[model samples]
Target: MRYLTGYSEAVRAQMQAIHARQGLGRLLLARYPAPHGMRTDRALHAFVTELKTEHLRRAPPIDKVLYDSKLQVVQHALGLHTAISRKQGARLKASREIRIASVFKDVPHDFLQMIVVHELAHLKERDHDRAFYQLCESMEPRYHQLELDLRLYLTHLEATGERLWSGSGSSGAHAGADPQPAAGGRL
Candidate 1:
């Protein structure tokens, strides 16, 4: 199970309750990619390096990166919609800290890269307006369709309770592992 580290115990308990009641644990586990035998540090670093490269290519420098292992639960997404500005594909440098969802640990490289592209776009455009989507489209073609597909994929995973990717079937699960801290970055 993924733990929401750093959050209040009460909030964490509340999250646990919500996830249990909704059967989110089973849903997420069933759909989440199984744990890979490789070291999370090595794999996550490689992935982030690629993401950072793409981020530097068209977007401004990212200040700090924060990812939640439990963010995949979807139920924990409450209140963030109001407190934090929602950007479909972009945000400005002046904008507040950004939060993103990884959904599954062993996600496809292309799909994960696509999401990084989406968040990087946010660093440029802070809304889902035409211009914002235009920028996203420029960064990633078929932006509209890709967004729809991604949402649909998540929805389908939820509906059918199927795993996204297969991995080593070790009992030690890493589907929701926290991001490892890098020199100037955190997983």
Candidate 2:
């Protein structure tokens, strides 16, 4: 219920629909395949970089991108986009960075794309205004849907304490709510 909290009635209804589907017969995630070939930070960077090159060509380049273990989805922050600016002597040096919750490592690629695009959009737009959302939509056409479905995925995780897609692999990995991998990540 906490995971489903903060959502509107319509979204909660949608989540119930998905939950019913998950319960009546099979897990809803079965219908959505997990992302493959991106289990490591390096692979994830390459994936994000490709997306950046494709849509946000003129946006500021990302200085750092990593799967942060400290990013807990329970706090409602699936991803973070930050510009660390510090003045050294007379010039201000800033680095744009993106941090994705490690919980997403096992989610579907659509969900991952949604979060990544959301963060990437921050490079150009600081606020979640019209232009910010427009940029998110431009990067990921199904941004809203994927976000809702991702919420459903989190709700499922909360209710069942099962990760539909586990770290070992989608086929054989047993479900575990916490799949905390290593701390240090490759760029």
- Using lDDT, give the best candidate's number: 2
- For TM-score, the strongest prediction is 2
**Pairs clashing in candidate 1?**
89-122, 90-121, 90-122, 90-125, 91-122, 91-123, 91-125, 179-187
How accurate locally, in lDDT, is each candidate?
0.44, 0.67
Misplaced by over 4 Å in model 1 are 1-59, 73-99, 167-187
Among residues 3 or more apart in sequence or in different chains, the pairs in candidate 2 whose N, CA or C atoms overlap within 3 Å are none
State residue 77's C-alpha deviation in candidate 2, in Å.
0.9
lDDT of 2: 0.67
In model 2, the runs with Cα more than 4 Å from the true position are: 1-11, 17-27, 73-76, 167-187
**How would you encode candidate 2's per-residue C-alpha lDDT over 139-161 as one tens digit per residue?**
87777666555656666666666
Residue 64 lDDT in candidate 2: 85
Candidate 1 per-residue C-alpha lDDT over 34-150 given as tens digits, one digit per residue, 9 for 90 to 100: 444323534544554566575446654444444545454553430011123456567623323333443435544444545555555566666645666566567667554434333
Candidate 2's displacement at residue 141, Å, is 1.1
What TM-score fits each model? Answer: 0.48, 0.78
